[model samples]
Target chain A: MPKASSGLLSRSLAVYFKDLRLELRTKSGLNAIMMFGVTTLAVVSFALGQSGLSPKVLSALFWIIMFFSAMSGLAQTFIREEETGTSLILNLTAEPNSIYIGKLLFNLTLLITMTTIITPMFFVFTDASTDNILPFLVVLGLGVFGLVAATTLVAAIISKASVKGALFAVVSFPILMVLLMVLVGATEKIFDNESLSAVSSELQFLIAYVVVMTTISLLLFKFVWRE
Target chain B: MWYKLVLFVLMSIMIYFSFALPAPQQQIGESSRIFYYHIPQAWICVIAFAMSMFYSIMYLRKKEIKYDDKAAIAAKLGFIFCVLATVTGAMFAKVTWGMYWNWDPRQTSIFILLLIYGAYFALRGAIEVEEKKAALSAVYSIFAFVTVPFLIFIVPRMVPSLHPNDSIISEDLKFNIEGAISLVFFSALALFTVVYIWLFNIGVRVQLLMRKQLEEEDF
Candidate 1:
């Protein structure tokens, strides 16, 4: 058995590759998430029939897509670990801190990838475009950073929960509310061709939220992960 | 017992002086009276959460059952304070903002606080084994406490607030007086702290009593 942590990046990369390989082989969590994303986008687009899909509304719609998709993905991140009973084995064999950081990094990657795939779909389905794509991506990326950090932390807490689904949302949604606001504000700016600095307040908040959430989660993860 | 006596006295002074304090310089004149309970409730909610986190750390580090009990009690009390804060805040909002509910950061965060702690209790109720319940709830409590400030304070402040961001504390304290009213607020804070400790001790004792009864039944 190969030791996972060659270093932080390699270790996280290793876990990411392992999860990706397994997910690819099984075609389960990721597939479910992607299908869910597509159905969600389609349903939302059809639901808004002829409302003219204004840029502001498109921005909000984009975030709602990401939010629901992230929750569906994260809820299973640990559920799979638990199903295989790999959580205990991992706990015994590896450093708990490394496991947390590793999972967080992987979840971040999944969110970024999912958002990457969905952003274009969101663009085509709605009336968004490539003109402000880079700035829009930047805002989406920052918001996802906050989302992954907060969700992974909450997921760890809710993972052991007996009543899982409702409980996870209860623990996560409130904190995510801030990130959602910033993401929406930034998206609006991107669509309007405004400077990223125009939504600088929201940007600063997105950064602070990611920092605070990650710091606290790292400190508290060990306690929550303990049997 | 002594803590309770002191608490009662402090609470009496607080209630008595609340009726006597001068109205604050603002639009929400008579409604400002709600702060006499509202502010203290919110502050204690924070305090209870902090205490829960501190005990959580101690329990995990020491693997002590007593620390677990302490954490559990503090969390229960924290939940009570969170509810009080929300209720008092709703009353104040109705009087000042002309509505019982608004999406003000303060209001939103407190509501979230209630949900988080509500989930905390639900987690505790779901687990059946005594030791597992203690360990898991301790872990969740610590995480939830860590989550609260971010959810309740930092996030809300990041966006604009309709509620005035004016200072409740001193802008300049050099000449500030230890007036009768300040005394009342401080006293209320002191009283709440006492009530918290007493309630916590009682909770631990009750848990112990229940455990012994269960043991007797097992025998």
Candidate 2:
């Protein structure tokens, strides 16, 4: 059992690194995501123009940018494989679980990288302030994890469909609505100068959302991947 | 045919009682008359979605085309009922809350339900192969249903909302509704379930026939 499990982990890591190398070399997914994120941020900041937005609106705007950025790039993980005809090779080499894990890890890396860059830019451009920095980070971590976990399986599903672009966001937005709602709530509270404990329920919901989403995605990914 | 006749008679009586029997609610007055129609539409919407999920699971387990047909038909009916619920609820909100759309938790949840199934139909449309479409949509159906509990029950209660909490059932687990209101409300709920079942059966049969016709044409 241990040997089999270790094999799974190693194979998954192999898939992850393969994706990372491809991403680094081609830079299509990262470039699209970052360019979209930065451009949207510029347009939003330019449009709003020192209006002194409320915390609720600012928190919502932050996650909206993240959401659209994810919609822009995350599907590239599987779509690339399908488009380039590499999925057949990957399917032969690794188990569905391993491929799912690898792609999930790859998407996580892309999303975290995008978040790290876009977040500070978001704060600077909008002049958004959160009194509780530690809690804000925690919320951001959980929120991003939940977002990627939920979208990864969806990316796989949409890759097989004939129509790809807007379909991904249309299908994913409803599933991720619960995650976005909780993230916005937690971030809004933090921006309102409330302590972490005040938003504990929202944090707990975020944790629960991530756990539930990842579990189902892992369980369901094989069905999507196999066919 | 007899059951349909009985349904017609029962529905007429129910509609009549909903309007003619109960006294106008104290606060919202006659606007509360929408409760019978609105709540039943919402209840049946959830029921149809649950049925869709059940059939989706069945399709995945048995790999049967019939289950896929049933699942898709149930979703189509559910989407229709969901729209009915939303429109009816919006009218109720307009009368009571002085607005057409409040973004209340219930309202938001139902709206998301609409979008979820809208995406379901879109996904079906995007796939041309029969088995793949069936399998993929069944998988998507199950995934969407897994989020319904969170969307309907948990998220709505998480925030303070203008939606009434104790209108039907109280904290003490007793029915807050009295006499005629309770009678018509429960009757409407039961009747709507039957109505959904009737529609679902017809839809599945029609879908199966259409597929059979298409297959014959292909040959």
Candidate 3:
């Protein structure tokens, strides 16, 4: 049993690394997401035209960019597999659980890398400030995980559809709505210089969202993956 | 036939009493009458979504076409009721809040509900293969239902809003319903649920028959 479990872990990691290598080699998914994020930030910053926005508006804008950027790129994880006809080889090589975990890890890496690039640019462009930097980072981390967990399975589901792009956003938006709302709320508080303790409920909710969404996605992925 | 007649009479009585009864509260006055319709529609909507989720799970477990049919019917009915609830709630809000739409927590939750179920139909429409449609939609249905608790319960409490969470009970959580209002409210709830079940049965039968006809034509 121990050996079997280890094999599963190794296989999952292999799937993750394979996707990572593909992403790094092609850079298509990463490039698309980064360009979308940066372009949106540029457009938004240009539109505001030096007028300072409130924390509420700024927080909303930041997550909106993140959400749309995610929508633009995350589906590529599975859609690429389908488009390239690699999914059949993947199915033959690994279990659905491992494939899902691997794809999930790849998405997590992609999104984190995207945010790392976009976050500073977001603050610089919008002049958004948060006093509680640690809490803000915590929010961003959990929000990214929650977003990926909720949408990874959805990416798989939509990859099978004819109209993949629009369907991906329509399907994912409602699922991510809960996560986005909590992130915006917590970030707004942080921007207002609220203490970590003040946004604890939002923090807890984000943690719960990630855990619940990840678990549910793991359970449901097999159904989407098999056929 | 007998039950349908009974349902018709009960609904008529409920509607008449809802208006005839005194205002549930003095301040909201007659506008409060919308509650009789609004709450029941919202309740049926939630119940129908739950039914859809239940059937979806059964379909996933049993791999039966009948369960998928039932689930789809329940979702279609749920979506209609969801829209009805939103419209009626908006009407009530307009009467009381002096606007057609307020981003009140309850309003926001219902709006998200509409989006969630709307997405469910979009998912069903996207898949071409029948089994794939059944399987994928069933999975998505369960996935969407999981977020509903957060939408309905947690989101409202997180934000301070004008929604009257304590309208029926005070802060201390006391049960306070006038005798006449409770009668109308409970009856409305029961009758609306029956109406929902009746519509759901009709929908499922129609769906199964349509599918059968399609199969025969193919044969």
Best-performing candidate as measured by DockQ? 3
lDDT of each: 0.72, 0.87, 0.87
Candidate order by DockQ, decreasing, is 3, 2, 1
The list of candidate 1 runs beyond 4 A from truth reads A4-8, A53-57, A128-131, B1-10, B20-27, B147-157, B161-178
Q: What is the CA-based DockQ of model 1?
A: 0.41
Model 2 misplaced regions, further than 4 Å: A1-6, B161-175
Give Cα distance to truth, residue B163, candidate 2, Å. Answer: 6.1
DockQ of each candidate relative to the true complex: 0.41, 0.74, 0.78
- The candidate 3 chain A region of ten consecutive residues with least summed lDDT is A1-10
Residue A181 alpha-carbon offset, candidate 1, angstroms: 3.1
Candidate 3, superposed: residue stretches over 4 Å from native: A1-5, B161-175
lDDT string for model 2 (B1-219, tens) is: 999999999999998998887543655578777878887898888888888989888988888899999989889999999999999988877876678886777788999999999999999999998888988898898888888888867776665533554342222124357777788889999999999999988997888789899999999
Ranking by TM-score: 3, 2, 1
Highest lDDT: give the candidate number. 3
Evaluate model 3 with DockQ and give the value.
Answer: 0.78
Q: In candidate 3, what are the lDDT values of residues A20-122, reduced to their tens digit?
A: 9888898999999999999889989999845889988999999999999999999998999899998898887788998999999999999999999999999
- In the range B106-216, model 3's lDDT, one tens digit per residue, is 777888889989998999898899999999999999998899889877877786633554353131123245698888889999999999999988998898889899999
Superposition error at A139 for model 1 (Å): 1.4
